[model samples]
Target: MRYAGIAWTDAGYRVEVLDGAGRRVVEPSSWGAAQVSELIAWLVELAQEHPLAAVLDSTNGLLDGPMTAAGLAVCRADPWLLPPRPRFGSVPAHRLAEQALRTPGELARVTAEGGTLTGRAEEYFEGVRRSEPIQAALTAAGRCFEHGRRDTPQVALTFDDGPDPVYTRRILETLDRYGVRATFFCVGHHVAALPDEVRRIVAAGHEVGNHSWSHPFLPDLTPDQLREQIDRTGEAVARVTGEAPTWFRPPYGALTPEVLATLEGHPTTMTMWDVDSRDWSRPGPERIAATVLESAGPGSVVLLHEGAGDRGQTVRALPTIIEGLLERGLEPVTVGELSAAPSDRTESSRQPAPAERP
Candidate 1:
């Protein structure tokens, strides 16, 4: 196996390939961004002899489409996880190669397993995942709480990218059967397409949250774009439900300084989750149930998705998850009901905004 690290600056990109033994196989080379085709051709030729895993900084997400299209396995190495680089130097491309070769679990992938960060990478992402905007916004005013009050015996099961005609309705039925209320973070466009579905969520007494307009990576949007995404979704949800959302969860948990600043004074609690079910992967009903039951406890904000894909697995796991939480004497409730300070949510802790790897 070969590990190829691709790093870029405003000027261009640099590529370095190394074997398992840490010996350079492909000498370090630089390529202009426009030379992506040439770069892909070079990598394709090399891959004929050795299986190559192309590792890139999260900032170089633009290259993911081209690299993966060329049949190279693509992995992301986040700058937040790397050791501080020299002020005048970029993160060493060779270091990325070594990390990919060492504990590959630390890196997220565009293709392969391992949903949440594992091993040392987990700790690094957890420590640095909070966007600058979250910190600044919370420092000045309101709070960004991942979980509610730990002392409470309540847990919040929050769903993102939802109001789907199929899964959302099924999830609502399951919740209705269980007599439980959860939060749904919905996208704007989805709301418009399925206003009745979103209305059902509110009519059933579940909390609705703004999940951006089209669910794009929040950090990538310009300030105006960010505001529009938020406002549009908020308005759409309010239009359908006859009530504006009081909570906001950035899509993919991706937030930026601009996002926080723009949302500052928006009168919505910036809600995140402490426990990620990783149900998006549709691991299995049992696996999903166990994942939630294992980490979920008092005041836990559990992440689940009801829309944007075939969520039959998540729907299957719903009953077991609810039963397990009940058996443990923890009541599942909405984010608003679980958090004592929902109106003035305040916390400085955050997880790094993970790259949108598909």
Candidate 2:
């Protein structure tokens, strides 16, 4: 029997289909609205090829109506309920504990900061525990990440929107001087133009990841457009680095359904940040440093930028951020190293994604 599993993940609404061999694979979206008259029309066409059932983890199984309308069967199943999810891969246990145990004041502060992290984590993992297929889809897609460990001092420092001819080099030099490892998510166009910068980032023992092609808001693009953004970026980075990035950050962290449809089989995890430096706003280095040092703990992903602006202050603040983190007994690692399981974690420990990939 052919079946599909659907869950909204760090990506958009994630849809996985069981192929003829009963192997779960990413479902190619036929609802592109290009040639299709309606989503139901497309789903109906899909049904004619084979009998299909949908297994959903969310009580909000938002896809149920469309599936049933398309003449497909709907079944409530929790592929993530018992084993894999919330525990599988590298879960930021210490981070989740911090979130789940937020004090009233802290909760109010997070709310004021527009953070929905705690609620999202609580709901997603609860479903992951009961649904095997849903868990598989998320896991295979590299949806796992870690924050700081409860007993140890390990965190990640991630910089995005870079390969700026000047600023990136400065950041690299600083990181090298301090013998620190950080993760850089580079844009495709920038990578192509400055393969040298990308190489420099990789050569310095830092992790490199795809940050998309032109830095478009992904949700606004079609499936084909999104795929181009991802594939071409991966190709550009792979051409210079010899290995395709196993990590991805949506441009401006804008992940929506149309956006994630293109990432089905890609061998990359979605990386997110736990701490916000707000450096992109041109916040002074002092505020940036204070934000990270005060909010960071065992499993935090500190977000900063390099190419999106002058980045001089960020360069200046780099040493202070590192030193302060150290004084707090926190060890900084790359996003790849920080993720507990797939080790390609994004540590989406913070709230809403920034403008695009952060």
Candidate 3:
């Protein structure tokens, strides 16, 4: 899937095609917000022919409605996730921070540039369901788990869907620098591409878990594909660490009955988070830190990202998260360690259940 970094060009628009890594793909060109809907429509039709994730800058009340109309799903994305992204062309060059950079009429503009073509787009674009009914089935089967028992005062920190060459190493270094050992749930393809990082992670005495081969929504894949996703990811992790990862976190936390049944005896635990950093949205470094720190406790598993877009916000928040948690008297441990510790079982009893995707 190709991502684009777009900017407003004095009178119109400009964009630079980017790889998922936020690497430049093409020379910048004028393609302002006005063209976003058409592009979204084109992408929607194209997805029927090929798999593509539409990552866009659609701020200021633009694009998402059109995307929803074009049969493409809409999830909030943080510009921080894609650093050095194309800013609105009108933004001042002196601005050092990306989030601080903005267009002149963001909140002030109340009218849509193009009149609603809702009926036309709806004829074609259809929204996907939040999740399959299988989630409830898995919950009933007792296969879905929001977290482990919080017996002790130590909380486990698990980083997901990464092993990226840049952020992963920085996170590992931060953990090592703090003398904290956390778990990293890695993707198979990423592990293959950066096996050295995997070795470095294990060498640092941090735990590694499987996060599937392709990061697909397990319920969307056929049973065979799901099995391959689980098995292949474990193999890749084991190939580097000499032992299969003992945990599995479903991509997007979209676990289903088939998912649990497929790995019934695979020695992997289905892990989910009670607190989401929302770093992927790049709210701010301070807010990210606060979210993790505020929700942390004896058995809290804070959902933080090390990969999938730029995680610099996560990096920025790391030291604060560590320091704050420590000050609050919480120790960061791995998920495996969290489950293994005999839980008072009551530490998290009064806490609200994690709002994991069901």
Candidate 4:
């Protein structure tokens, strides 16, 4: 059987084509996606000359389309290319440190060496390091597409600063009644305070995102600190819900270039709202609903808050907001579903959810 491997590097992608005996048929070097596709096609033709089963590294999901199009059976490489297992358990923060400590071992070496960890050790260690969780979340997010599903216009409803023991339940109940799904951007402290609420949010078929560990302005922190904020929050959420958050929203609509760079390879998508209801300021349900309706459009991500103080306006606005979107020919979806693509619209018109009512 022949195998092909593709790796993205600082210079570009390195494509390798191997023959039946695992001998190199093509040398590896920087190649663009289109060139890589051409190379793969050539390799497949060569493989056909030998009539052998072909294996290809598809960790990035890049070859999914082309491989399937070419009638090639593509299997994802194990997190680190180790033997198959039932599941790769969570990688603890300390384990990541331990792996780093190894410095020269296979586990530590892969990450330190800087390439896509495509082997078994890489996947296992990544899970242990909480790397896989965040990456998985981000992968789920990037899969969001607009015209891929159907032509019917769909909208997503998202609420930040939530999982509040008091208000989140009410919001969930409303969502349940309407058979709608929304995304909740949760604070680490809040999730820690109300673990049950966090679980309930997940169980109710809703999506959750990281608002931050303490809701700090991302731009205010150093790159390392910003990562810490996101990591800590992801760890907390994963601890309670068995899943890491895949979406992130900077507090106060603040994000810096450093913050973006810090998040580059972490796997969570940066989510911003499109339709702002201004419900955080006690804008009244009528005004909140009206604002959302006025701004609603195809692929809109509406921002609402279930917790963060005096969310009564948002709570009251829910049915009207959903109804209004429906009235305007929009289908409310989760932020995961909304921000899946560049063309996807998100509603960010709302004020910050009120922390306290004056």
Candidate 4 ranges with C-alpha deviation above 4 Å? 1-152, 339-358
Please give the distance, in angstroms, between residue 54's alpha carbon in candidate 3 and its true position after superposition.
Answer: 6.8
| lDDT value for model 1 | 0.73
Ordering by TM-score: 1, 3, 2, 4
Model 3: weakest 10-residue lDDT segment is: 107-116
Comparing 1 and 2 on TM-score, the stronger one = 1
For residues 102-217, could you state the per-residue lDDT of candidate 3 as single tens digits? Answer: 32212111112221221222321221122335444443555544555665677788888677778898998899889997989887756766789889998998889888764543
Candidate 1 worst ten-residue window by lDDT: 349-358
Number of the top TM-score candidate: 1
Best by lDDT: 1
The RMSD (Cα, Å) of candidate 4 is 19.6
Candidate 2, residue 225: lDDT: 55
Better of 2 and 3 by lDDT: 3
**Candidate 2: misplaced stretches above 4 Å?**
1-148, 341-358
Error of model 1, residue 59, in angstroms? 14
TM-score of each model, paired residue for residue: 0.61, 0.56, 0.59, 0.53
Number of residue pairs clashing in candidate 4, backbone atoms closer than 3 angstroms, sequence gap of 3 or more or interchain:
29
